[model samples]
Target: MSLLFLLVAWSATVLSCALLCRAALAAARALPPAPEAAGDIAPDPAAADRHASGLTLYEMAYLSGGPHRLADVVLVLMAQKRRLLLADTGWATVVDPVGTDAVERAALTAIGPEGQRHIPAVRDALVGDAAVRRVADRLETQGLAQPAAVRPGIGGAVRLVKGSALVTLLSAVATYWTAAPGADSGQVLIWFTVPQILTLGLWAVARFELHPYSDWATVAGERRLPATTGSRDAPDAPGTPPGSLITLALRGPTALTDPSLRAALHSSGA
Candidate 1:
């Protein structure tokens, strides 16, 4: 490669790699502190009770698996309560028109005034319900979940990093093609590999750090979830049955331990 071409290639590599690092670091720093940062501080007994009391199983379902899981939990619970009928052939018919909470009301409305709807359709409709958004908003406000707005920021940063990697690759290819014959193409390739390696390394580290940024639950909220697998034990909320609490903790159609109910949910794509 000509001396000028080599300089340009290195400059592009360096600039792209630097930009990737900067974007990744900025996204990481913008995250809230570790969930356990306040662990050393003891909470007041009265306040702890109040906090515990305020967290219903519906909220827990949202924390465990986001809106879809919350919808599943509500549907199964309604079935268990005889407020809805779930047929093994993949249908849901409302047995009770009245709903005791916003999530239930949303599910009911999704089922429509006709009182019947496909289970998957109801679940899909409920996922975007205002009631479901309110549930997310509440959890975000309580620091139990990441804010919806924060997710797009990190997502956009990651996309930019990927774009930078692509730019580096294309620049390397162009430089390789433009080099004069008898130039050490292998050496040129090695020089280009440095930025590729840097980009891959940064992506690996970023993935490790950001793996826990899931759609639902911060670390603190995850810590509070009852073991949903292979266990049915969980505390019940007022006016909520123990069975309903168990179903909510399980978080989705998999929680439908009854064979018929599970079949019904699965058939409907739940």
Candidate 2:
């Protein structure tokens, strides 16, 4: 019975290890080279121009932080333009019935024709909004973001390996409990060390090498992230500087320089 337990543990460990390796390879193949790795090459002028010009602010927000971030950007921009009211208490009231872009239009639709809704509800609604989906689709089409289907593949593999590790540990305990009375249970437990070591070692390496495997951006999109890391004290108000919103998109709500803006953002969904 002890030997049988060892066999089962070994089989699971080996299978999981193989799966881990395969997942890592698949993830590596799916991703383009790291952004910095391509620095030596010259960019195509027309392609670079399109890349710079075609990407809108809302799309940048999505690339930085997905749907919620895009929603935040729209809200902040609208508030600045006096088209919407973002109360410090987390309520959003639309002032202007018109929207400047698809994302803003979606936000308006989420708020309903009455022009009032809680900010959190708007953020949640935007997640499944067609405007957000279009942004994701366009990014994927341009090879600037990973497909939603492939994003979870490596993460799922990592979780499976973690489960396999737990099984190996339990099997070790079972081997000791099921051993013949005269047999050295410690020695039987020693057999489990092989699988345990295999699982743990691979887990550690995978954690290091594939840490950001589930992130939204592809290498190209990541490379295009704004360079501004805004100050907490930057005091950025709407229409103050273009980089202010970009900073908010990249760094999240914490980067909001206005106290009311910060409060509104945190109270909404922090």
Q: Highest lDDT: which candidate?
A: 2
lDDT of 1 at 243: 41
TM-score of 2: 0.66
| Residues 1-270 of candidate 1: C-alpha lDDT, one tens digit per residue | 434555655565566556546644654464456543334434322122222424556667787677778787788878888999989988899998888777788899999999999998998999999888876766665566766545544445555556666766777788778877777777767776776776667666766665443456655565555543212344443464444444545456664558888888889887
What C-alpha lDDT does candidate 2 achieve relative to the native structure?
0.73
Please give, for residues 41-67, the per-residue lDDT of candidate 2 as tens digits: 343221221224245666667876778
lDDT of 1 at 80: 81
lDDT of every predicted structure (CA atoms): 0.66, 0.73
